[model samples]
Target: MSNVEHVTFKNRDMYWEIAADIYYPPNFDESKQYPAIVVAHPIGSCKEQTSGEVYSAQLAEQGFVALAFDASFQGESGGEPRFTEDPSLRVEDFRHVADYLVTLSYVDAGRIGLIGICGGGGYAINAAMTERRYKAIATITGANYGRVLRETEGSAEAVIAKLEEIAAQRTAEAQGADWQVDGGLPESTEQAKELGITDVDILGATEYYKTTRGAKPNGLNKTLRSHMGTAYGWDAFHLAEELLTQPLLVVVGDIQGGFGAYRDGYEIVRRARSTKKELTVVKGWSHYDLYDKDEPVAQAMSKLTPFFTENL
Candidate 1:
């Protein structure tokens, strides 16, 4: 096991700071340059949960320097009107983290790779498309937020209606009204059932986020209501077939429902123009199972470790 150090750095081209944890392999030597991996968390999650505690920790143990960081306006990072989930800014955050990694003498700048979980997985793919710094990319239950929103809303008319509502709320806030925040998961699985949220994905999310299994104080699980409209119109996989040329790995569970990761994973694998790409479907596992479940995580790592090793 390796010790992780908590740190913060200014986000380039942005005013606020980004908080992160850097994991060093056991018996790490600063004098030697090592390949590094950037681990990005799911939406409504912080570095402390699966990103840093699980994936980053394991990647470091496998002899690579792994970084897990909070996105610009979420987690411990400094930003105004927090919990904003802007897709463009989220994609840019990966490049900014790569900038920081390159300045470190212990990191081999040319061998940097990425691991994105849930929504972060989608952003990671988008980032890697334009930014060549990431030599390889892997997504665990990767989800495109915009596509998911569009699909789950049932119709384009419904999406537009929601966007209209968001626009009105933003206008109201600009006129000195109080900001409206979206709430997180239900208090418990029972409460979720009562709310009629029976989808395996949402139910699993409630269980993971609301319980001791994956809860962290900074993983507030809320988002600014006004900022969500940006995701409705954005697409994480836009032009992926043309611009995504890096070695790619997509890992997803078999179970499917409200959350679109399972389908999105296959879609990305199908769309990416990467010369070397692979998709591993974890049988019998739901989308959230890969979040922290021992078996699923192990299965994902088995593929990820080799993919990164071969590519990076």
Candidate 2:
């Protein structure tokens, strides 16, 4: 196994700092430049919480330079109103990472690629729409953040109403009404348990977000800014359709009921006039199965190594 080093860089006019872990292959040589992959972590989670860091380590062992990063406003990165999620800024963050990577003597600037997990996958595809420098892109168990925000578990009208309520809370806070947001998990009820949420998928997501599994001491589950809602504005489908010049690889668990995102994104890539694309579906795997399991992780890495090796 090769040693991985933790590092940080600045972005967004230096108003923000991005934290990352760089994995160097055994007997790494500065004299020889290598293909590089930027690995982005899941939404509401830091680099270390998800499998982004682990996957980067494996990529390093396979003789590639892999850098896993904590997105802006999360993890060790600098951003106001901690834990606030912004899709546009997230996409720009990926571009900034590519800019930072190309400056390193050990990185092959022309051969840079990206690997995004979960929510990060959507941002990666969104970034590729404008960041042509990225030669290849890959995603695992990905989610289209915009779609989820607009349609998951609630109707569009209902979601808008909830957003409005949050905004009102923010207004009250600005008026110094002694407003305080809950910094912990939502309580589980028997009704939730009957929905197959034995642990944290449905009811436990609240707990998971508040605990060490996905939470940081400075992170927040609620934001006071109304513009935060606007972050989910762009259509990932449109982004995929427009940015099909680069080679892409989409991987998903076939049994996961939420594979629609992967299917839709892959179809866009396949229809592109200039891009070459491939899709891999793992049998009997669920949404979170690829997060840390060794078998699925290994299979994903195997597919990733060859795809980037050939395209990037």
Candidate 3:
């Protein structure tokens, strides 16, 4: 059991207020400082989503202080250009959350850890690389959104065309056009059918984000189209084999015929420099299954709880 409460803090990058939830152990004692961990949500997601709050609550139940936060310019966080999914800023936000964690008298600053879900996982890796304050780090069904985009959208010509489209949007906005939004996954079941989007990875993800299963109004599947280039250039595990020296845990799904998490998690596990690292593949779980659903969560948390406990 754990106690959940709303919290807010500033992002050091620009001092903008970021929204978050603090999950404390059910028997939390303010007089005693406890190890803490930061939980990062997926791209286009908020603190309330499955991977963010769900994992935070679970960790808190295990006697760890957990903080789940919305990235800057998305969810309930304060920032202009709403829904800007900048990788650099996202990575910096993790460190900023760590900064907030250390300020709490009941949080053990030196023993802090981090858990990131989906796209957040990549940013967490980037953050953990230089922010040694994170003694341990982990990502579930992790993905480098930039890399995912590249794989999904083929060709240099296609990329150049996207860049051109974004550039045109920027110009149109300057000419007083309405704020254009770039939607990610389909927002409704009807829309999925209309698009003929049958990819299991995307279909599974939409089920979580577009349906009542894990949907949040403020967390619609959209971001500014201008963020395309930023996401395209940023690499989540930019220096894994070389600079990521912290204890790393990469949990991938063995579902979708084992292509679910392997696409990203396996590569990271292969390259990360952590002498203490583990890549646990959850059987019969698809990429999106890790977001919620009782069985998959149980499978993922079994390993995560122990990993954080042993390391953090």
Worst 10 residues of 3 by lDDT: 254-263
Model 3, C-alpha of 233: deviation from truth (Å): 1.5
Instruction: Report the lDDT tens digits of candidate 2 across residue range 88-166.
Output: 7788898789878989998999999988887788778778878888889888877777776666536868777767866
Model 2, C-alpha of 143: deviation from truth (Å): 1.0
Candidate 2, number of clashes: 1
- lDDT of candidate 3 at residue 285, scale 0 to 100: 78
**Model 3: CA > 4 A from native:** 257-260
- Candidates by TM-score, descending order: 1, 3, 2
Error of 1 at 7 (Å): 1.2
Give the range of the ten consecutive residues with the poorest summed lDDT in model 1: 1-10
* Winner on TM-score (1 vs 3): 1
Stretches off by above 4 angstroms in model 1 are: none
lDDT against the true structure, per candidate, is 0.92, 0.71, 0.83
Cα error, candidate 2, residue 80 (Å): 0.9
Q: Write the per-residue lDDT of candidate 1 for residues 165-283, one digit (tens) a residue.
A: 99999999999999898976788888999998879998999989988888899887888999888899989999998999999999999988687898899899999999899999999
| lDDT at residue 103 of model 3 (Cα atoms) | 91
The residue-level lDDT of candidate 3 at 149 comes to: 68
Better of 1 and 2 by TM-score: 1
Residue 135, candidate 2: C-alpha displacement in angstroms: 0.8
